[model samples]
Target: MSLLLERHGQCLCGAVQLDCRLDNSDVSACHCQTCRRWGGGPLLAVECAQPPVIGGGDALGIHASSDWAERGFCIHCGTHLFYRLKAEPHYAIPVGLLEGEDWSLASEVFIEEKPAWYCFANQTRQLTGAELFAEHGQPDDA
Candidate 1:
């Protein structure tokens, strides 16, 4: 199936909760410079089929990370929440924020920006930024 049934996750301080309809169980790693600067490393995130149902008081903070994408986080605890596309109904939530064991790193994007200091042993389908951006202006798959 293209979409997993449902998944639940929360911020580090439990100030924010999310009910997400995941597009798939597989996770993707973004090695782009923006991702690196945002998270200090590759962002291991899962794609959501639609906008997550977020429940939080005033602890949620959103930043326009780029012209086409935005990043959400917990203001109280500084937990990385989701990286979302502004032009589409797409959300990529950090795998660690969610509770699940079936998640696996399926692909890596912006391979050219990946640092040489670290590496993953798992064999994953990888694409450089140019290749990814050339795929109809988006990644071929989430």
Candidate 2:
């Protein structure tokens, strides 16, 4: 499929809308408990260098999920919109948000913290939190 030049997404109640452009397809499935609790599964996300052009920005609620991460959602509908890196200025939008297409990006970043009851059958690279952080800089203590 064509790389997204512009993508459109909206919240559950349509109270928040976003338009964005992304170049990379490096998506990941985050299994951290925080992520699983927030989205009810591994969060499938893709990266965007620039913030999406948002409409009804007033309806969005942001929570600092960690020292460097924040979660954004619709206050009215409680739809998770995106997760952002507080220091990096980049964002990971839920793959479900891209209006009308099925796009498979890079699938990695699974935290071993995932419950044994669930297993990802996809042939994607699987890494625990420590592995992911080690690949970046230090090992994850979480």
Best by TM-score: 1
Clashing pairs in 1: none
Over 1-142, each residue of candidate 1 has an lDDT whose tens digit, in order, gives 3546598999988999998988678889999988999899999999888899999948999999877789999999999999998877878999998887888899999998899999999999999877866763665433
TM-score computed on alpha carbons, candidate 1 = 0.90
Off by over 4 Å in 2: 1-4, 134-139
Best of the candidates, lDDT: 1
What's each prediction's clash count? 0, 0
* Lowest lDDT block of 10, candidate 2: 133-142
List, residue by residue over 2-103, the lDDT tens digit for candidate 2: 565577889889999988788755567888888989988889887776888889989989999987679999999899999887756678889788775646
Clashes of 1: 0
Computed on alpha carbons, the lDDT of every model, listed in order, comes to 0.87, 0.79
Error of 1 at 27 (Å): 0.9
